[model samples]
Target: MLSGERLSAIRAKVNRAQCSQNKKSATLSSVSINGDRITERKKESFKTANSFIIRGKIEENETLTKRGERSLNCAQQRYVVVVNGKAHTVFTHRCRSRHCQNCQRIKAFVWQEKMKEIIPELSINFKNGKYLFITFTVKNPKITNLRLVLKCMSRAYAKMFQRKAFRFVVGGIRSTEITRGKSGDDEAHPHFHAIICLKTTYFKKENYLSADEWGRHWGECLEAEFKKEGLEYNAADYPKGFPRVDIRVAKSADGKQEITNKNIAEHGDQLINYVLKYSIKGSDLLKDGKADKWFWEFDKQVKGIRMIAPVGVVKKMLADLERDQFDYYKEQEKIEKLIADDVNFKADKAVFKKEDDFDYYMESKKDRFQYIIEAIEAKAYNYQCYYKALLSDHLLAFRSGIDGIIENFKKIKNTKTREGFEILEKAEMGLVKIQCERIERLQFICDALVRVGLYKKMSDFEYVNIHTKDKTTIAKNNIVGVMKAVEEKLLNDFNQDFMRLENAKSQDVFNTVVDRVNEKSALIKLVRNEILAAGAYAYDADNCEYIDLETNERLEVIATIE
Candidate 1:
């Protein structure tokens, strides 16, 4: 019953969809899961840094106590769940949804499933409910140089079973790791979490090495590997510390940390889920409930990334995680998925297909791309090239890794100056009308200040702190300009406060050498490198064997009154 025109339109749509399949993104893969790409920028917001930092402590799941293990399994047996506040109870063995499930054993079940998929070679035997949970961590280096790191790690993982390399007796070794191509905050930095299996025989020779020791060894091994690649680093000089490797272990009975990271490489059943998590479009930035508890609006509206941790929220997560235990991991996973869902909505909100320039282009793709894929189930095309020049341009415009720019902008709050500072402040927010006009006016003033002869010594632009879109440049400019203004003001103040150079004259002093003590102007002794100024009180001078200021306390570069 369809009209010929409508049918033609449908066919064209199908052709475009088919052509999309052959297309490739410069920084992305073609795979998609749950509407989330394998590794894409998370599109969402956040107002604080606590969400990820303090919660880092919960990275390791706990081991259950001997007595607790029995109860944990018993609790996992068939149970009833009442949806919401409803009266009727649904017959169920256990709830895996981290929040509503009683005993919430799904975390364990999920782990089991994932292990089989990712590390099929792992030989795990939980006898008497004793399963050792191990975790691995590593510091991320300059993101641009990831090839060496990944290559080294791959080698190390493969050599785990070799006693000569690791110096431990272990057999049946397997490695399963989950790598996040970028961070949840939307910074495209790579990091990996790997889980491995080792023979139980090594525990007998050097048993009780402490779980921390294991983590340290793992970190050290990675360090050695990085050093080989010349990618190792020292964090003592960085303003904010980077991530480090951790080797924490827990017994299967003890898995309690309220923070559930779905990307962890513990088990394999969640392979698709884990893979989707690494994708840029799979973040949970949009949600009305607890998941949307934090983040700034602009971050959400823009690329849907850049959520930092708030001080208060970090404290709460820490307090809650301290009480986190193995008995509740399953419940946390559900909450995590919901969070993931929220982030995904924001990531995929807009899709543009260009590569070189951050702009959309309309170019014929009949030659470059072989086919284009539309959604999941669209028709195919063969004559079209697999890659279209138009798609290449789209990829280039989608900016996700330029975090250095954002970091620099964060420093605007420190600039000082009225015209210059205010202008920068207005620019930081990209606000409307009045503020925008003020910024423009300031720019004019900045240009004029340079041209004015009176302030010639001061550069046209100087460092200043003002909250603006580009705070870094404003701060740098304001500093020089502010200093120039201060110097001129000081000169003017000095001219008004005292006699002029015309009144200069010399005075003669009589050599009245007095031998008495109290009358000799306190008889202070001379000091080496002693600071003396118009208002400085020099009580603790050098050669002062007995001075009031020369106490037993150690001297400091700058002194504070006690």
Candidate 2:
């Protein structure tokens, strides 16, 4: 069956087919190798960034500790989230620190989503109106004066709006942003970004303010505030007495007369994202091999500052929308809890490699052990550097010890007074201090939540009169008992003073009794008002329940109004 020429041709064809298959296999192998390298590089980059963040946090914590201030620590206490494959997906944590890059990214995403929902409403409401993006800036200030500069900037913006010409502004959003200055300038540059809603009348030639006029008005306001604050002003430093102020009319994609809903949404999204960017860049904190002075000072200055605020109609609408959303989320959570037993959902466990294990795993086989040892040394060295830096601050060291001593003294006083007549007086004083601190901390948390539009403000809560029904339980009964105890204490103090006044032993005794009654009444009333204001409810004798005015679920009442 084999002809010589035909057999040779067939052999050639077979050889060609084999060669082609081999080539494809080689190509695939190469591609697989390249992909592995890319993934490795990505993992390395993530680890490096994570390490930097951890180091920065440690340094910040050290500084704060030295100054006897509250700082974000507890690196291990992170909210871990796993996504995708067991080995394929990179594990991460929700650090939730203000200066964390990962947390900031998540925050930005949340902000974008919220803005996306709200922007369409804004477009519909102000269909006939025009939009403008205005940026108000001030000269970069030294780290020491950053807080004051920020205060001045805020006051100036408020003052500018108070002017007769700015009466046309209906609704707008304001965000305070700070960035590190580069080259030949002080580091902290504070500015304001405002998404201004303008009436149609503002588009007219007569009413329109050019960029130059905006700069001038901004400068005047800034300068006046600066003078009032007694801050040094140099005409040469800022020839215009203010940093650059930019104003641009927002336009549609096609540059047409009528702006579309899509255009408004996109524009609003961009402005909000820009405004909501991290107050301080993480990179600025730990640059190169050392932490910058600016980072430490900036952290101290920005404590308790409200970085974002909405004004006018936008504020009211946003508040109402947020409240509704919060309620919806709460209801959804309740439903999920109810159905949790029936739902067969499997959650993927996040696998976080320990720092040492990660380092060892990432190393090449040839020098793995050596690399691990070096990595350990490097980490130890970094900690030493942080410790050294903290020690260098003499003032912080002195201040830190003072707080410790005071705390120890308080503890000692408590133990020593256990067997003495003065025990009640000391205990009462300590209780007062503890109560004050608790109130302050609560207020701080509430303020932060309100600032971020996560929770309703006190005034808004009062307006809504939102209340939660209480259930019958031992815990609930105990809460009721505490409330009664508090009430009884107040009544007993009042009754004792009244008896003393009735006796009228002497003029001095009568006056003292009267003063004591007035003081006790004022204190009791103040405490009751504060509890009610914070959304705690009084016990209802008829219902045999203590309803909660703050939250939807039944919770133990720590305090209540009369």
By summed lDDT, the worst window of 10 consecutive residues in model 1 runs over 375-384
Estimate, for each residue in 453-488, the C-alpha lDDT of model 1 and write its tens digit. Answer: 111223333423222322212112222222222223
**If candidate 2 were superposed on the true structure by all CA atoms, what would the RMSD be?**
19.8
Give the CA lDDT, 0 to 100, for residue 506 in model 2.
95
TM-score of each: 0.25, 0.48
What's the TM for model 1?
A: 0.25
Clashes of each: 96, 0
lDDT by residue (1-562, candidate 2, tens digit) is: 1235633543343322111223212221122323233233223334334544565567775543423221222122211111121121112223354554445555666655665667668778777666777788777788788888888887777778778877777677777777777643456777887777777887788887888778778888888888989997665676665568888775544455333343666545555576666666554554552445666567678877777767766777677675322232332233334323422211112222343332112212222123222323332343334433443353243334334323433344346545552664465445444434433333443333333223344442111111232121111112222233344456576677767778988989878778777755654444444344445655456654445564543323232213
Candidate 1: global Cα-lDDT?
0.29
